[model samples]
Target: MTLGNWFALLVALVVAAEVVRALRHRAVRQERWRRFFRLRTTSWGLGILTFLLAVALAAPLLAPFDPNRQLDIVHLTNRPPSSTFLLGTDPLSRDVWSRLVYGTRVSLGIGALGALVAVALGDGLPFAALVVAIGLTSWFGTSRLVRAEVLSLRQRDFVVAARALGAGSSRVIVRHVLPNAAAPIIVSAALGVGNVLLLEAALSFLGIGVPPPDASWGNMIADGMPSIYTAPWSTFFPGLAISLVVMSLNGVADGVRDALDPREAP
Candidate 1:
């Protein structure tokens, strides 16, 4: 695998591990899971995200052709969807279906990386400067949300009890404050993935994203712009992918927020 593919695989593994760990937690299993699954939107969103993640993880095995391979510039370029090419060929004659499959890895990998950086550092960097820039621009809202949650939780009786028990600040913050503050952070991260994906696509469209020969939804859309009328599938498929992912993420975020809200009736 190429370095980018390796990095994407690593990120996917780390995310999967984290998810497994989270699922094994008592609170997540008993409370969060119960409430989260109560919402139909959450179920649908989770299903869609899971399918996309699976597609990304299985890209090498799933993609029919190399994303960067141009079959024939003269004859195959900008061809409409056919039995051979599922989505169609782009201006470069690369398989759109193949690129779309691979692009899932790029889009989700970068989105997950950016969200992690934003949560971990409040504002941070990534392997791609574009990812870093998206995280930096997006962290403030999450930071504010977390800061509010932390401040409110700090004044609670449990935090006071922990402080009285001589727990160190770091221990108290990690065990007491952050755990209670986790719901909003988790929701923010989920929502942030979609935002980061959109931002990355925008940057890529503007010629500063994933770079050529490597397929990204943004660059794919940009490449299709000139031939949009003749070959609308080129732009339509990628844009639809983006929209579906973002909408699914938003649904999940809203469900999570509702599920975690103390004010909500059980």
Candidate 2:
């Protein structure tokens, strides 16, 4: 019905599609999944990320007030958190909780979408140009790591045998080289999600992000700056969200790196 509703619907559809695809195709290995959960840091990271994503996906259902509608401007302006207002009212009298809930879409959507664009295109593209830019810039290390792995894998016995057995270059590379080289790429991707979020916050703080009436954590922080002395919660919650998300992502990346390392035992 509304833009936020549409965005929430889009997120739900994408998540459902991915789940269906994974179930139907068995995209990830059972052992790897088991191993992933066994890692304490990654498991915790997964839990944290899952909670944040759930909040984002359920924004329409969970948000109590309209994120955009200003209310009680006279009586409720900048009220502190109470049973009536979970997080409090912003200077505009908009529910901070609602904005934070909706803001989840802006922050995580940008991070996830930007990461996908970066990994898929490896260069600039239309539509998500800013995301692409961030992704492309962040992918250099991943590219180099992948390249080195590819070079090393090309000389492996399996690759040599695949070639000798009449396998095409493309098939050999895709089946053998790329699979072997996927560890660092996956780790880098995990780390890149966190980086993108941080960058988005920075850009939004500078007044160049999903603009007003549409709450992004960065812009929320910016909006609360003048009221820092009077209402600290407005800025505190969003900054805390950013910090936690980034830390969780980094933890996941580290766990994945350790998990996928040849030296580590499953």
Candidate 3:
């Protein structure tokens, strides 16, 4: 009936789906995923990211009040943090905590979705037209990196042996070249998450993204500027959320890069 109830229902459904997926793939070892979080930095970043995502997902359950609901004018405006309102009220007398939680969903969702789609497509039309918007942008760098690696790899003794055994170009590339070249491409993708989030925030700030009624970090900051002197907390929390997410992503990326680098001794 309430917003929290709806969120609880959604969470239940998500859990159900995950259970079904796990059962369907029961043959697959879960260690593969666990290995990814083995590094201390990656574990910390993932822990933060997981917490944020949990907060966002359970926003309705956790927020003390609706993000957009204005409280009684006499008592709620620009109030400092207290038991009644943990993070204090915003300029509009809405719950700062609620808005921050919802805004997390908006900003992180857009950034992550955009980056993943763009990276997965590998410079396809949608990758350029919607996500990154370019002719040869991040794609160019990744392609060049892969090409150089492939070129060097193709000259290796293993590749020569494969070719000598009548392996087709496609077979050699797929079997030998790609497996070796995958590391850099993966590292680049991990780093790109931070870059994409920044771009999403910029777009939201400019009024072209994650429109009103739905809180996003960029829009919240934009909205708070006019009343910043009177209500600084309104802007501070969302900005902090953005900073944390980006920093966490970068930390995870760096950890993953180091862990995967061939030059690093085990």
Candidate 4:
């Protein structure tokens, strides 16, 4: 199988495992969800993320024009928002709204996949070299966090009882240690998504990521730089996108951390 195929399979398996785990702890999961939704910032952040996800998923239907297609250069180039074009046009007469919608897919996909790889494998390959690089480099902190949590959890009474009840090391770790240590892992992964998004944008801005014609927020901002004074929307919109996503992710992460806190558990 190809690298992408393997990655997909891994993600599927991880998601299935999580679903099974949640089902096994349905009441706890429901309570946690309640706590999570109760936070106003969490709801707001999740609302924004849900909207972006919908836009990304429906890009073909939502975007009026092809993100990379340049049209009517003489008349459409650098045009501001209007009835014909919502976010306006770029230097090449490409629709900003279309590019922005498609860019949401690129940004969120990379951020989510990179965070999953970092949290799951701790180190990985080059299916998407940028994703792999970001995941590999960023996992160290998460690994340390997991390790500390695991170390603390290993000595807990439940873990000791599991081992004493003839459970093997693997069983003890999976059934006793990991489920308890999961809170920090989840929180770290949530925060890591924002970090990965920022890193991807920085790399793209430096011309090393998500190559041209692919409307990354970073490169879009770079493209808008020369026209900043005359057509500020070009750079402004992309910068605003980055800021909003990063901030939303941070807020969601904070909410998840609080919601998952043992102290907050009923």
Best by TM-score: 4
lDDT of each: 0.78, 0.75, 0.68, 0.75
RMSD vs true structure, all candidates: 7.0, 6.6, 6.6, 9.0
224 Cα displacement, candidate 4 (Å): 0.7
Q: By lDDT, rank the candidates, best first.
A: 1, 4, 2, 3
- The collision pairs in model 1 are none
Best by lDDT: 1
TM, every model: 0.76, 0.76, 0.71, 0.78
State the weakest 10-residue window (summed lDDT) of model 1.
Answer: 118-127
How close to the true structure is residue 57 of candidate 1, measured as C-alpha lDDT?
A: 66
Mark the regions of model 3 whose C-alpha exceeds 4 Å error after superposition: 1-39, 73-75, 114-148, 155-157, 262-266
Instruction: Report lDDT (Cα) of residue 23, candidate 2.
Output: 37
lDDT of 1 at 168: 93
Q: Is candidate 3 or candidate 4 better by lDDT?
A: 4
- Residue runs of model 4 more than 4 Å from their true location after superposition: 1-29, 114-127, 156-167
Candidate 2 structure quality by residue, lDDT tens digits, 1-266: 34564566456656654653453343256555544445566655665677678778698776778988889889988899987777888888888888998898778877876336333654324325656666667778778888888888888998999999999988997788776677788988888788888888888888876556678888888878888889998899999999889888887787677666554544
Q: What tens-digit string does per-residue lDDT give for candidate 3 at 21-66?
A: 4533542454433344446666556656766777777777867677
Alpha-carbon shift of residue 202 in model 3 (angstroms): 1.2
Question: How well does candidate 4 score on lDDT at residue 73?
Answer: 84
| Greater-lDDT candidate between 1 and 2 | 1
